[model samples]
Target: MSPAPPTPAYRRLSVEERRAQLLDAALSLFAHRAPEEVSLDDVAEAAGVSRPLVYRYFPGGKQQLYEAALRSAAEELRHCFDEPHEGPLLPRLARALDRYLAFVDGHGAGFTALLRGGSVAETSRTTAIVDGVRRAAAEHILSHLRATDPGPRLRMTVRMWITAVEAASLIWLDEGKQPPAGELRDWLVEQFTAVMGVTAARDEQTAALVRRVLASEDG
Candidate 1:
C-alpha cells in the first residue's frame, strides 16, 4: 500500500508564527461569539494545539487573550479611516466608511463585545483600547476636514459625527445589517454633510469648511 504514503514530516512554527496562529483562532471565535462564551479550550482546539500551550503563551488566561484580540481589532479599526486625501471630501468619507462598515459586518458579535460594556472580560485597559479607536477615528475625520486647529464647535461637530457613526454601527448589527452597507455608507456621508451644515449656521470654521467642500464639489 506504499507504506501509507510515507507520512509527511511535521514542521515547527516560529514563536511569532505560533502566537499569530493562536491569535487568529481566538479572534475567529471572538468575532462570532461573545468573549464570555469563548473558552481557551475552544481556542486551543481551533488552533490544533493543547490547552497548556495556549496557557504557556498567555499566562493571564482568557482575559489576556481577549485583550490581545481586542487590541489587534482596535489597531485595524483605527486604520480604516487612513485614506488618501486625493478625492472630494464626501467621496473620501464614503470610501473610509466602506472599510469601516466591512469590518463591522465581518466582526459582528466581536464588535458588539468590544463596544458594549458589561462583558465579564471588560477591563480598564480594554475600555481604553476601544476609546483609542474612537479618538483615532475622530482625529482622522478632523484631518479630512483640513482642520488643524478645530474650534470647539467644529471639534464637537466632528466628534458628534464619530459618535453617531458608532451608534449607527451598533444599530446596524442589531438590525441584522439591514439598509444594506452601501446605502448605509451613503446615508452616513449625507448625515455628516447635514450635521456640518447645521453646525456651520453657528460656527464660522464649519461654515468655511462647508464652503470649501462645496467649491471642491463644484470643481
Candidate 2:
C-alpha cells in the first residue's frame, strides 16, 4: 500500500490550539462581517482548513462558532476586571478606566459582536460585568479618600461618581470618540478626583459647559 501523506502542521496541533486558531480566524471574519453573514467555507478558507474540518470543530455549525467567539470576548473582559491595582484609589481607578477604554478601542468589534449575539440573556450578568469593573475602580477611589477625608456620605458619593464615569465612557466611545484618548484619560482622573474632594468642582462644571457648547455646534 502507498504511504499516507503526513498531516499538515496546523492539523497536528493539539485540540485546544486548533480551537483557538479557528476562533482567531472566525473573530477576524466576524469583525469584518456580522456573525450571521459569516459562512463555514469563509471561516475554513480564512483558517486554511477544510469545510469538514471546520464542521468537526463546530458540530452544531455557525451558531456554535459565534457563541465561542462571544464567550471568548466576554471571558477576556471578565479577566480584565480581575486584575490587581496598586497605589491610591483615584490613580488606580483612572488606570482601570484607561485599561477598559483601551480594550474597547482595540476590540470594538468583539464588544459589538458579544453585545449583539443575543446569548447573554441575563441582565444581572451584564450589570455584573459592567458594574463589577466600575466597583473595583470605585473601591480604589474610596480607599484613597478614606485615607485623608473621613466622612459619612463618601461611599454614596463615590458610587455615584463611578456610575457617572461608566456612563461617560460609553458616551465618549459612542459619540465619535471625541477629546482624544489622552484628553479623555485626563478628564476621567479629573472627574474622579473632584468627586473624591481632592480637586475643585468648578473645573468639572467648566468642562461640562464646554462639552455642551461643542455639542450644540455639532447639532
Candidate 3:
C-alpha cells in the first residue's frame, strides 16, 4: 500500500498576522450579514479559531471586532477610488467607479449596515469610518480633477456627486445589483460630466476643468 502523505508542519501565526486574519474573517462574515447578526463564534468559526482566541484579540467582544472590521473595510473602500493620473479623465473615473462598485457588490450587507445606520453595532467610530471614506474619496477625486484649490462650487459639486454615488450604490444593492456594474459605472461617469458641465457655467475653475477634460478625451 502507498504510504500516507506526511502531515503538514503546524505553523503558528504572528501577532499582527493573527489579528489581521481575525479581522479578515470578521469582515467576510460582515460582508453578507449585518453586524448585529454576527457573533464572535461566527467570526471564530470563519477564521478557524476559538471564541476565546477572538476575545483575546478583541477583548471588548463583538463590538470591538465589529469596529476593527469596519476600520479594515474602510481602508479598502477608500482605496477603491485611487486611480492613477493618466489618460482621459472619464476613463480614469470609470475605472475608479468600477472598483468602488465592486467593493459595494462584495460587501453588500456590510455596506448597507454601515450606510443605513441604526445597527446594534453602530457607534461613533463606525460613523467616523464611513465619513472618512467619503472624505478620502473626495480628496482622491479632486486630486484627479487637479482641483487642489477647488472653489466652493466645485467642491460642493464633487461632494454632491459622491453622495449621489453612495445613494445609487445602496439602491443598486436593494434592486438586486441589476442594470450591470459596467452600465452603472458608465452612467456615473456621465453624471459626473453632466454635473461638471452645469457647475462650469458658474465656476471658472470647473469650466477650465471641463475644457481640459474634454480636450484630453478628444485627443
Candidate 4:
C-alpha cells in the first residue's frame, strides 16, 4: 500500500554511522596486525558480516581497509581540536594532551600500529594517519601564534612547535611510556604553551584561515 511506504527513501544512513561502521571493521583488523595479513574474510568475520558486505563498503579491499583504520585514528585526534575552549593556551594545551593520551590509552593497538608503520599495508596507513595528526598539531600551534604574533614568522614557529611535540611523544612511546601519564600531560602542556605563546594571546586570529582551509579539504 502507498507503494510500500516508499521504502522510507531506502533509509539512507547518516555519514557518521557509515564511517563508524567502517572504522569498527578496520580497527579490529589493525588491532590484530597488518591489513595485508588480514583477509577480507577475517575482517568480515570480525565485523560479524559477510565478505561481500565488507567489500560493499570498501571495494579497494585490504588497502582500503587499512586506510580506513588510519583515517579513523586521524579522526580521533582531530576530535581534540573540536573542543570549544576559550582561555590561556596552557589549559587548552593540557586538555588536548589529555585527550590524545586518553585516545592512546584506549586504542593502544591502533596507535601503536599507526606509529610503527612496518607492514606494507600499514606503511601507507601510517603515512596517512601521521600526516593528518601533524597537520592538526601544526594548525593548532599556528592559531596560537597568529593570535599573538600575526607576523611572517608565525608559520615557521608553528612548524617547530608541532615537530617538537610530536618528537617528544614519539620518544616517550619508544622509551616504554614510562614517565607516567600525569607527568607527560603536564610536560606537553608546558612545552606547547612555552613554545607557542598560548597564554599571551587573547584570540586565535589564524584559526579562521585554517578552518577555512580544513573545511575545504577532507583530511
Candidate 5:
C-alpha cells in the first residue's frame, strides 16, 4: 500500500454555516432529549466543537439555543400541512398528516418536550412558537377546504379538527405508535369527515362543504 495519503486541511465554515451546524446539533439533541436535560456542552460535543465556540455563536447560552431549535422545529411542522391543491381534499389531508406524523415519530421525546409545556426550558416565546404552528396548520386546512373567510361555525370545526389531530398525535406517541401510521392517517381522515358531517347538520356552511365533498367523491 502507498504511504498514507495527505489529510485534507480543515475547511472553515462561514458564520451562517457554523451557526446552522450548531443549531442542527442542538436540534438533534433536543429531538431525543428534553431541552432542560440537554446542555450547551452536549451541543458542542455533538457538533464537534468547543463549548466556548457554541457560546460564541449563541451568546444567550442553552436557552437561546433551545429557542432557536424550537423555532426550527416549528417551521418544519408548519410546512407539513402546506400540501398542494390538486388532489382530493381527503387525500391531500392524508398526505399532510403523513408528513406531520413522521415528524412526530422522528422527534419522539422531543415532541413531548415541546408540546407538554412544563419543561424548565419552556418560555412564553416558545409557547407562542408552538401556538403559531397550530394556527398555521389550521389555516392550511381551512384553505384546503376552500374556506377563505370561514364563518364562526366552519372555522371552529376546522380548528377543532386540528386540536383533535394534536391530541391524537400525543396519544399515538403514548401508545408507542401502535396500529401503524397508515391506519392512523385513514382513521384521522374518517374522523374529520364524521365530525364535519355532524357539524353540517346544524351549520349551513358545513352542509355546503359536505355536499361539495360528496359531489367530488361521487365524481
Candidate 6:
C-alpha cells in the first residue's frame, strides 16, 4: 500500500493575480453565456472564490465586471490579425485567420452577443469597445498588405473583407461550428485573394499590392 501524499499548501493570490483570476473565470463563463445570463455567483464558483469576494474586487457589481470582460475580449480580437511580416501575404493571412477563428470558437456565446448586438448588456461603451476592435483588426490586416497609403478602393475592399469575416464567424458559431475551422479559415483567405484580384482590376494601388504579394510568394 502506498502512503498518502501531502496536500500542496494553498498560497494566497496577490491582488493583481486574484483580479486576473477572477477576470479569467468571468471570461470563461461569458464565453459560453450571454452577459445577462451570467451572475457574479457563477464567476465566483468558476474562480473557486466566494461571492462577496467577487463584489469586493468589482465594487460596481456585475456591470463593471461585464465591462471588464468585454474590454479583455475586445483587446484579444484586436490582436487576432497581428502576424509577423515574415511570409507571403496569403499564408500569413491564413495563420491570422486560424487564430481569429479559434478565438471565435472559444468565445462563441460572447462573440455572438458582441457582434450581433441587441443584448441587454450592450451599451455605448461596449459598442465603442467592439468598434475599436474592428478598426484595430483592419489596421493590422492593412499593415500586412504593406499599404501605408492605400487608395479609397483598396481601403474599402479591406474594410469590407473584415466585415465579411465577422459575419461569417457569427454564422459559423450559429451553425454549431460546422464545416471545420480550418475550412472556414482557408475559404476566408481565398475570398480575400479573389476580392483583391477583382479590386486590382480597378485600383492601381491594389494591383501593386497584388504584384508584391505574388512576388513574395514566388521567392
Best TM-score among the predictions, by candidate number = 1
lDDT of 1 by residue, 1-219 (tens): 444542211237788988888888998898899999999999988888889999999999999999998888888887898899876888889999999999999898999888987899999999999888888988888888899999999989888998899999999999999899999999999999999999999999899999999888777
Candidate 6: 10-residue stretch with minimal lDDT: 3-12
Worst 10 residues of 3 by lDDT: 3-12
lDDT of 3 by residue, 57-77 (tens): 999999988988999999998
C-alpha displacement of 205 in model 2, angstroms?
Answer: 25
In every candidate, how many clashes are there? 0, 1, 0, 0, 0, 0
RMSD of each: 2.2, 9.4, 2.4, 9.5, 2.4, 2.9
Model 1 residue 58 CA deviation in Å: 0.8
TM-scores of the models, in the order given: 0.94, 0.60, 0.93, 0.68, 0.93, 0.92
RMSD after Cα superposition, model 5: 2.4
Q: Per-residue lDDT tens digits of candidate 5, residues 81-173?
A: 878887567888889999999999988888888998899999899999999998898888888788777889888888899889888888898
TM-score of 3: 0.93
Ranking of all candidate structures by their TM-score, best first: 1, 3, 5, 6, 4, 2
In model 2, which regions exceed 4 Å deviation? 1-11, 116-176, 189-219
lDDT on C-alpha atoms for all candidate structures: 0.90, 0.63, 0.90, 0.64, 0.87, 0.88
**Clashing residue pairs, backbone N/CA/C < 3 A, model 3:** none
